[model samples]
Target: MTCHICNTPSNESFQVKVLFKYDVTYYRCHECGFIQTESPYWLPEAYASAITSLDIGLVSRNVRWAPTVEAMIRKWFQPEGPFLDYGGGYGLFVRMMRDRGFPFIRQDQYCENLFAKHFDVTDQPAGKTYELVTAFEVFEHLADPVATVGEMLRAGKSILFTTKVLPNPNVTPETWWYFIPETGQHVALYSLESLHRLANRFGLQLYSDQHDLHLMTAKPINPTWFRWFTHPRKVALYNYLHSYPAKSLLDHDFQAVSDSVRKQPLKDLI
Candidate 1:
C-alpha cells in the first residue's frame, strides 16, 4: 500500500476487527510516519449519520475550542478577512466563530449546515480567497489527506486544524481509542513526523502543540506567542482571559449595521 499523504510505499502494520464485523487492514509508511486503513468499503454505512454517535462531544468541543481559535487568530492571523471552516460539521464552529465576530463561511458537503445558513460559501462569489481556514477534528476523517490539505491551501494561506496524533510505539492499536472502528470514519492518521513531511511537500511551515492543535502556514507566525501557547499552563491562562464577558472582537452581528442606521445626511427624513 502507498501512503496517501506522501505517496510512499507502506507495509501492513496491523489489522483490526471493526465493529466486530469487518476485518480492516492498517498500513504504515516509514517515510512519513503516516498510517491508513485500506479503502473504506464501509464508509456509506459509517457516514450515514454525518455526526457519529461516538462524537457526542461535537458541540462542546466546538465551544471549548472557540476561544483557542480566536486567540490564535488574534496572535497569528489578521483580525478581518474571510475564514472558512472546511468539513465544518453542522456549521457549529462557523456559527461560533461568526458569533464571536469573525466573518466565517461554512463548507461541508456531507453534513447539513444547521447553524450558519446565512454564511454558506456556496452563495459567495467565486475565486474569493480567505485569510484562514479551519478544519478542526476533520483531518483524521480524510481518506485522501494530501488532496484535502492541498484544497485547503488553495482556499487560504493558513490553516488551523485539529487532529490527535498517534501515540508512541509502546501503545498498541487495540489500546487506542482514536481508531474507533464502529464509526469507520477515521481512515488516515498522522504523527508529528508525518505532518512535517506534509509541510515540506507543500512548502508550508508546520507548528503544533505536539498533540491535537496544529497550524500550517506559508507566512511566518510570531514564534514567541506560538511557543508560549505550546505550554498547557500558558494556554489555560490565555483561555481564561478570553472567556465570556470579555467579548471577542470577531463576534457576529446578525443584522447589517450599515443598512440599519441611516446615513447622517439622509437621517433628516426620519
Candidate 2:
C-alpha cells in the first residue's frame, strides 16, 4: 500500500477484526509516519449513523471548542465574511458558533443539517469564498489527505481541524484506542511528522496543541490570543460570559464588559 499523505510504499503493520467480521489490515508508512487501514469496504456501515455511538462527547466537544474557535476568528479574520463548518455533522458546531454571534454556515455531504438547516452552504451561490473554515474531527476519516486538504484550501485560505496526533512512535495499532476498527470510520492516523509533511506540501504554517486541535494557515497566527483561548477554563468562561443577556440601551455597558474581559492579561489564564 502507498501512504495516503506521501506516495511512499507502506508495509502492513497489523490487522484488526472489525465488526467481528472483516479482517482490516493496517499499514504504516515509514516515510511519513502515517497509518491507514486498507480499502475501508465497510465505510457505509460505519457511517450509517453519522454521529457514531463512540462519539458521545460530540456536544461537549463543540461546547468546549466553540469559544476557542470564536477567539480565533476574532484574532485572525474580519467580522463580516462567511465562516464555514465543513464536515459539520448535524450542524451542531455551526449552531454553537452562531449562538456566539459568529456568522457560521454548515457543509456536510453525509449528515443531516438538523440544527442549522437554514445555514447550509447549499443556500449560497456557487463560487462563494469564505473568511475561514472549521473542520473539527474530520481529518482522520480522509482516504486522501492531500487531495481533501486541497479541496478545503480551494474553499478558503485557512482550515482549523481536529484529529488527535499519534503521540508515541512505539505505540502500535493494537494499543492505540484511536484505531477503533468497530466503527471503521477513522482510516488515517497521523503523527506530528505526518502533519509537518502536510504543512510543507501545502505551504501552510502549522499550529498545533500537540494533541487533537490543529491549524494550517497561509498567514501567521496570534500567539497571545491563541494562549488565551486554548485553555478549557478560559474557553468555558468566554462562552459563559458571552451568554449574558444585554438590553439595547446597555449595549455600551456590555461592550465595556467584553473589552475588559478580552483585555485581561494572559497571566491570569495560568
Candidate 3:
C-alpha cells in the first residue's frame, strides 16, 4: 500500500496477532511516518454494529474526563452559536452542551437517528460552516487523515480534536496491544511534529497537551492558559485544581469554571 499522507511506498514493518484466522499486518512509510493496515483484512462487518451497541454507562464514563476537556475547549475556542460534534458517538458531548443550554448538532456514520447531518470526511456540504467542530478520539481510525482534516476545516470556523498519540518510535507487534487487529482502525500514528505539519499545511494553529490530547484552532489565536501560566509550580497548581476527579469539591469547582468560561464571547477572540 502507498503512504496515505505523502504517497510514498509503504513496507511491511510489523504484525499484530489476534484470534485464530485474524492476524493483522501493518506497513510503515519512512518518508512521512504514516502507518496503516495492509489490505485484504480491514474492518469487520460487525464493527459498526459493535460501536452502536456500546453501553451508555460505559460511554458516560468516557466523559468523566469532560471537565478537563471542557477547560481545554474554553481556553482555545470561544463557544459561539452552533457547534458540530463530528463523529459524535452516542451524542454525549452534544447532550452535555445541550444540558448547559448550548445549541449543537451531532453526526455519526453508523447510526442515522442520532445524527443531524450524515456526511463523511470526503462528503461534507460546501459553504456550510460552523463556529466549532470537535472530533474526540476519532482521527486514529481514519484511512486518510489529511483528507479528513481538510474536510473538517472546511466545515468549521475552528476545530478541536483529540486522539491517542504514539509516544515511541520503535514499532513492534506486541507494543500495539491497545489497537484491534480486525478493525483496520488506529492506522495512523501522530507525533507532535507531524501533527503540526499537517495543521500548518491548512493554516491551523495547533496546541497539544502531548500527554494524550491535541487541540487546534483555525486562526492565530492562542489560549490564555498557554500564555499566562508558565511557571511549573503555577501550572501544576492550575492542573491540580482543574484535574479530572472521580468525585469531590475540586470536580464541582472545575465544572463551575467551565460553565463560566463557556459563557464568554467567542467573537472577541476570533
Leading candidate by TM-score: 1
TM-score of 3: 0.69
CA shift of 223, model 3, Å: 6.9
- Alpha-carbon error at 208 in model 2, in Å? 0.4
Selected candidate, larger lDDT, 1 vs 2: 2
For lDDT, candidate 2 versus 3, the one ahead is 2
**Total residue pair clashes for candidate 1:** 7
Question: Mind giving the per-residue lDDT tens digits that candidate 2 earns over 1-270?
Answer: 998887899999888888668898989889878999899888888888888888888998898888788767766776555888999999888877766676678999889998777678998888778899899989999988899999888888899999999978656756788887778888999998899789788988888887888888977876565667789788667646654441222344346446766887989646
Name the candidate that leads on lDDT.
Answer: 2
Residue 116 displacement (Å), model 2: 0.3
**TM-score against native, each model:** 0.85, 0.85, 0.69
Candidate 2 regions exceeding 4 Å error are: 222-225, 235-270
1-270: candidate 1 lDDT, tens digit per residue: 988877879989888887668999999888778889999888887878988878988987887678677778766677676799999988889878877777789998889888876678886898789999999889998888888888888889888888998787434467888888778888888888898788877899888878888899878776678767756567678867765443443432445433434444665546
Please give, for residues 143-256, the per-residue lDDT of candidate 3 as tens digits.
778898888877785777777566665555467543555444556766566677677777777877664556667666555565333334555466566544312223443575
Candidate ordering by TM-score (highest first): 1, 2, 3
Global local distance difference test of model 3: 0.60
Please give the range of 10 consecutive residues that has the lowest summed lDDT in model 3: 113-122
